[model samples]
Target chain A: MTTTLGRPGTRPSAARLGLYRAAIELKTFFRERDAVVFTFALPAVILALLGAIFDGVYPGSDVTSAEYLAPSMIAAGIASTTFVNLGTGIATDRDDGTLRRLRGAPMPPSAYVIGKILMALVVTVGETLLLLGIAVVAFDVRLPTDPARWFTFGWVFLLGTTACALAGIAASSLAGSARSAGAVMHLPYLVLAFVSGVFFTPVGALPGPLITLGSLFPLKWMAQGFRSVFLPDSILPQEVVPSWEHGRIALVLAAWCIGGMLLCLTTFRWHGRRGR
Target chain B: MTDTPAVRVRGLRKTYGDTLAVDGVDLDVAAGEVVALLGPNGAGKTSTIEILEGHRDRDAGEVRVLGHDPARAGLDWRTGIGIVTQDGADLTELTVREAVRHFARYYPEPRDPDDAIELVGLTGKADARVRTLSGGQRRRLDVAIGVVGRPRLLFLDEPTTGFDPQARRQFWALIRRLAADEGCTILLSTHYLEEAEALADRVAVIVDGRIVAAGTPATLGGRATARTLVRWADGRQETDDPAALVASLTRRYGGVVPGLTISRPSLEDVYLDLIGDPS
Candidate 1:
């Protein structure tokens, strides 16, 4: 006997579904005026304010304080787009029944994940350009012309964003509601910014214990990697170590990529905590 | 198999910590039949529907939907089902058309998004942001998304809970069309007796996590054989044959039978009795 229901047809490929999901995600993200402004502008505004307040060059280097901050702020900006935005955005989806609707559909879980990460990537790229424009215009920070430097910048951006995006997906489960997601995401992000020297110059100036703690996380390494691409080598002495520590940076960020995926697999929930 | 039921459950049970949401329960919905799971709040209606929709796990049960166990069902099984949940997602940032079109992509064969909007009577508001829609319009949008996939079996969980009287009637018409024209099987859960009476080919009354009664609207809880009351201006009596009694009363009253009326136990009365709700 044969069933009359459910016609036989090939499902849309996962890649095609992922692209569709990404389109919807991007459309939703950009349409929310307040979220768009907050996510894209907050880091740039902070960089501008810090650039204006700190007027002098760092000791023994031609780099002004504003120039010193440009690269670090880019790293922080990436964190904002991937980690903070994704964490809160996912929590809001849970509170509003988005996950329930998605779960009910025939779409694959991987497609959803791909959509979110791609949305973050597109937003982060725009955000990076915005910051780059501001740094060039307001802070006299030069854009690197060397192909090798850009090559370094490319890898760091991809790996750092992936790691942070995964971590954000894992962290989203901690928020009890959409309303509380802001606090849940921001508290850790602000602390990481301070400890990772996104707010301060010269990582060596921070307390040794703080440096050690920061080194264990991806944010500190991301900032160092960005600094190596944009800032002069003469400014390297101010780092916790005299060199860029490129090998360790890669290892730490890559490890975070792996560790974050594990955490997400263990902790991610499609439904809100209150849901059955 | 052609004779296989679209949905089947045996000894289904679920618990949330200390509270039992669904006790030992059995149900079956055959292909092309529209069944309503009628129950009040906390009656395990949502839990049972969610389990069948593959959105929740049951503590213990044998369940199958569309020839596959929902607990382990794949995407193909999901493609056969449409669900209109109690509360829908707030897709506030998306326009109504965009939301419908996006969901349509999830299915292998889907109705045109514009056609779905038209079917739900939201064609006028297709381009409006979802946040701008009124409560009833949003529910209509939910229905559009639910049906866009052209599902073979549909689950509507209190689809008209917050709808006004007119909106409820309109929704009922849409549901009737789907069942009659498309031959779609439906299992809808609602606490509204009137809704169940209006839409269900079969109604199952659930109380305290168990089905207490199940039958056609007229025969549920022995309603068909139940006595009817015949009343006149001066007197009333319950009898098996209301027509005969009314004739006798008309003769005794010399033709008109002043203020004569005859009534049987209504579906509401049988339902109230089944649920043991005195009010």
Candidate 2:
């Protein structure tokens, strides 16, 4: 009866609990290799492919099409990691009984959720690195040098990731099964990526109504933040247009985060049907 | 209220839309005692256990576990309790040790994960991923996680429902040790009457949301000293005292009567009768 499965002597501290849950969440995410490929890896590959294909498409445009596409991929990466990755992960966890097991434990609900967000953050970082690496080495895309702009990039990335992740958690509650979650992610992701300028220019280039519609989502604002960092300052002719108003972006992101969390808190079903 | 039973329940009721899942019920289990709740499928055994576990809210009743109403008890109260549910929905990404250690972090005073695994006889599988373990091994791991916190009261809802015979016996032995050595109060719900007979100090037969009979396995449904059926090669007769009948038969036949046997209703028989399912 002597087993090596002994627990640590003390209950893990809140900090330690967060770390452990994060580590486990990462492992669970990686364990589903197919999901990993579809959610994070596929986006990076698509970005690279499109960059290579459109290397010289719109010559003498204020920026090369590839340079324009690179910044947009940052927004795409955020959307992939936060909403799609999170929704599917939560749905699968619910379907698989992992959430119920966690519920039975004495862990705080906030800690459980924090762990999930942390995992999503890890994936977000990886996606950002992939897109940034491609932009730097393959496309000769210049790194933003202004300290102010770099600071703006950091804030935008964090807020964008949080907002998307929260929205994903909310969507997870609506999904009936893990497979459906994955399937449903496809349409929203493709349409939003295209319309939000993750694969093209912003609202001005698209139809007027489409511009208004695309600006409503977090993806458009996220791309604008990246453009503010990478785009030439002179192109933004109008002074103080609030094109990348960090405060407003933060507020909107916060609203989405709170709204998504409330929806998930209200509707997510951990205990699956008994027959299942 | 201070002298309340470890578990005191009265008029417990629950409904799922139109269906009355758990009708009015009453029962109690004292401190440091193990009680088994027994019934067939759809007999409201699980619904009642869920209500007691505080996982599901009740429609109406006074229910308490360890002096506090489970429905209203906060985290402080949940810490003192353990539960081993029927389903094992682990993500299977961590080693056995890692999973147990991770959950141990939640409790205020958890037992050593190693000790918990050892208690359930899964020491060898500690380093193995949960996905690699056999069904019985995974079940033991579930039990390990349930007890890692050294809970004062444990709720095991069909803990052995899917276990094979040998594994079921092993789990029962583990439960006995938990009760005797750790002095943990246990409420086990099972469809298997044999399991109740083996592990419970007292068994409560629940049917249609109410407890139909509650007593020691020997006296359930008047099982103790009930008519003993004596059977011989030529005939069979019911008697109050089988020993006296045997003695008289031995004298008449000068000892070693032909195929003479005494039989009493088994726990299953009595349980079936109590639950209104004699088949």
TM-score of chain A of each: 0.96, 0.86
Per residue, candidate 1 scores C-alpha lDDT tens digits across B1-279 of 647899989999999999999998899999899999999999999999999999999999899898888889888888889989988757999999999999999998999999999988999999999999987888889888988998878999889998889988998998898899878899999999999999999999988899999999989999999998888899989999888888788788788988888888889888888899879
lDDT of 2 by residue, A163-268 (tens): 8887888778767776688887767878888777677653346766666677677887787778778766543432124255667767777777778768777876
Model 2: which residue pairs collide? A3-B123, A5-B113, A5-B114, A6-B113, A6-B114, A7-B112, A7-B113, A7-B114
Residue by residue across B197-256, what tens digits does model 2's lDDT show? 999999998887778889998899899968999998778999998888889888988978
Q: For candidate 2, what is the DockQ-based docking class?
A: acceptable
Model 2 quality (TM-score): 0.89
**What's the lDDT for all of these models?**
0.90, 0.80
Candidate 1, which segments miss by more than 4 Å at Cα?
A1-5
Top candidate when judged by lDDT against the true structure: 1
Q: Is the docking of candidate 1 incorrect, acceptable, medium or high quality?
A: medium
The reply for model 2, stretches above 4 Å from the true place, is A1-16, A57-59, A200-205, A233-258, A261-276, B1-4
RMSD in order of candidates = 1.7, 4.7
